[model samples]
Target: MRVLVLTKPFGALPPGELAEQLAQAGADGADLLVRDGQTVTPDTSWRIAETAKALRGNGLELRQVSTDLISADSESERVIGHCAEAGVSQVRVGFYRYDAELDYAAGLDRARRGLASLAELAARHGVRLVLALHHGTLHPSAAHASLLLDGREDVLVHPDPGNQAKEGGEHWRLTLDVLGGLDRVGCVGVKNAVWEPDGAPGSWNCRWQPLADGGVVPWATILPGLQELGYTGPFSLHVHYPADDPLAAVRRDLGYLRGLRSGPFQSEPFQSEPFRSEPGTAPPAR
Candidate 1:
C-alpha cells in the first residue's frame, strides 16, 4: 500500500523542504490540508496549487486536498476547480465547523447536496471526492458516515484509526464493522495518540509516535483488518506529535508499519457461491 504523510505536520518547513522531508520519512505521497493562518477556507487555492506543484516536482504526488470548507456547492466547485488546476486526483471533505458544533442537519443536508455536486464536477475534471470521518462531528463514527453515503458509488471514505481510538475501542470496532463490506474506501489515516500520564486529568496528548511507542493506535491489528476488508489503499501518516524531531518519529513509525505481517488467521475467505455439478446428472462424460 502507498503511504501519504500530511504536509501540515511539517508546517515549519517551506513547501519544497517539506516535500523532501516527507520523502525521507517514507511517504509515497502527501495529503495537503490547506489552512490559511487564522481561517479555513478555499480562498487559498493558489497557495495550495503552488504547494501541490512543489511536492510533485520533488517526486511526491498530492494524493488528496483535505479541507474543512466544502459544505456548500459553490465552495466545493471552487475547491475542485483549484485541485484540477494543481493536478490533484482527489479531495477529502470535512463536514464540520471550527467551533466543534454539529452544523445542524440542514448543514448536513447542504453537505450531501454539495458532495453530490462536487462529485459530478470532480468526475468531469477527472478527480474523486472522499469524506473523512473526523472526530466530534455529525458523522463522527464510521457507521454515521456510511449512512451519509446512502449507496452512492462515486463517494469514498477516509478512515482515521486514531480518531476512532479516541471515540473508544468499541466505537472503533463498530466502525470497522460498518466499513467492512465496502468496496470504495480509498485511503486510511494512520495517526497515533497517547493517553496523558498520571497527573493529567481528562486529557489526552496526541502526537505522531512510532508504531512501537504504544501511544499511537495499534496498527498491527488495524492494518490486517483493513487488508481483509479489501481496502488496499495508502496508509497516510498524520504526525500531530510535538517534538524536537518529528521526522525521526515518522521514520520509526514507517519502519514499524513496513515490518508488519499478515498472520495465518488475519484474512477472511472470499465470499462466493459454491461450485455445483449439473443437477440430476452423473460425472461428465470425458
Candidate 2:
C-alpha cells in the first residue's frame, strides 16, 4: 500500500514545504488538498504541475487529490484538467448531505446526477473520482454509499473507518463487502475519532486523533483484511487534528501503519493499476 498524508492541516505550507515535511515523516505521497486556502485551490489550479514537480523532486508522487468538485462545470473540469497534467489519478469528490427539507430519494438522485456528470468529465481527462464516507453525509457508511455507487463503476468510494467508529460502526469485512467487494474501492481514509462526553447530560461528541491514539477503530485487523482481499491502494492518513507538532504525530502514526501493513501481501510486487494513464505521460515501464 502507498501510504499518503492527507494534506489538510498543513495547507498553510506551500507545496514544496508540505511535500518535504511529508517526505520527512516517511509518507509515500500527499493526498493533495485543493481548497480555498490550500496551495492548489480552484483559483491556483495552475500550480498543479509545479506542485507535482516539487513532490517528485522529493521522491514523492501526487497520486490523488481531495477536492470539492461536485459538478461537471468548468471549475471542476479546470481542476481535473490540471490534475491530469500533473499525473494525479484520483480525485475525491464532494459530499452530499442529508437535509430535513429534502427527500432522501431526491437527494440521492441529485448526488448521483452530480457524480455521473463529474465522472464523465473525469474520464475525459483520464481521472477517476472517488467519494468518501463521512459521519453525517449521505455516505455515512459504506453500505449507504454503495447504494449511490450501484451500477456505477466509473466512480469509486473510500471508507473512513475512523468516521464510522464515531457513528456508523460496522465490521471491516462488512464494509469491504458493502463497498463492491474491494474492486470499486479506490483507497482508504486513515484517521481515528473517539467519543467524549460533553459537560451537559446525555451529550457526547467525537473528535479526531492520530491512529495510535485512543480510538476504537482497529486498523490492525482492517489492513490485513484489505490485503487478503487483494486491495492495493493508498491509505490517505489525515493530519487535520489539532496538534502541537502534527508532523511528529504523523511520523508516529505512519510507523504504526507500516507495522500493521506487514501482512501477506506486503512483500508482493505492485500489481498493474487499471486506471488509465494520464494524458501526455508515458506508460509505466513493464
Candidate 3:
C-alpha cells in the first residue's frame, strides 16, 4: 500500500511548498484538504486540475481529497465535478453527527438520506464518495458505513482504526468481516492513540500518539490483516497530533510504517453472517 499524508496540518505552506514538504517526507501522495480560503474550495475548485498538475510536478499524486462535505448540494457537486475533471477518484466527505437531541433512529435516517444523495452525486460525477470511520458520529466502523450506504458500490469506507479505538472501538477482525468485501474500503486511516488519566478519579482522555512505540493501534497486525484481505489501497496518514517539528514527525512515521509492511499476521475470511436467529434474538443493523 502507498502512503499519503493528510495535508490539513500543514496549511501554512503554499501548495507548492506543501508538495515539496511531502516529497521530502517520503510521501507517495497527499490527501489534499478542500475548504474555504485554503486551497481547493468550492468557489475556487476550478484550480483542481492545475493544482493536481503542480503536485504531480513535485512527484506527488493528488488523486484523493478531504473535504467538509456532509450534504450533496449544488456547491458540493461543483467541487466534486472539478475533482472528477482532475482525475481524482476518491473524495473524503465530512462526518454526520449523532446529536444528543436526536434519537438514534432519527439520526440514522438523516445520515442515510444525506449519504444516499451524495452517492447519487458520486455516480453522476464518476468519482467515489469516501466516508471515514470517524468516532462520535454516525460512523465508527466499516460495518456502520456499509449499513448506512446499504452496500452501495459508488461509495467507499475509509476505516480509521485509531478513531475506532475511542468510544466506538471494535476488533479489526470483525471490521473486515462485514465490510462488504475489500472493494468497499477506499483507504485506511493510519494513526494510533492512547487513553490517559484525566486527573479526576475514573476519568480519562484519548490523545493521538505516534505510530512508533507505546501505542494501542496494532499496525503490526492490521497491516498483514489488510494484506490477507487483499487490500492494496493507500494508507492515508492522518497526523492528528501536535508535534514540535512537523516535518520530522511525518518523516519518522513514514519510515516506521515502511518497516511494518513486512510483519505477518494471518486472517481468515468470514464464512457467513455471525448472527442468525429471530428478530428479537439477534441485533439489527441500525
Across residues 101-201, which tens digit of lDDT does each residue of candidate 1 receive?
Answer: 54566666765676676677788878888887776665667777766666677878887877656655333445656865445577778777765554577
Worst 10 residues of 2 by lDDT: 263-272
Model 1 weakest 10-residue run by lDDT: 261-270
Question: For every candidate structure, what is the RMSD over all alpha carbons to the true structure, in angstroms?
Answer: 11.5, 12.9, 6.5
For model 3, residues 46-85, the per-residue Cα lDDT tens digits are 8778778878998889869988888889878998899999
| Residue 183 displacement in candidate 3 (angstroms) | 1.6
User: Best by lDDT, which number?
Assistant: 2
Please, what are the lDDT tens digits per residue for candidate 2 over residues 163-251?
77778476777777766577778889988877889789999888887787747776777787687778888889986578788789899
Q: Give each model's whole-structure lDDT.
A: 0.69, 0.83, 0.82
Between candidates 1 and 3, the one scoring higher on lDDT is 3
Q: Rank the candidate models, highest lDDT first.
A: 2, 3, 1
* Clashing pairs for predicted structure model 2, backbone only: none
lDDT agreement of model 3 with the native:
0.82
Off by over 4 Å in 2: 263-286
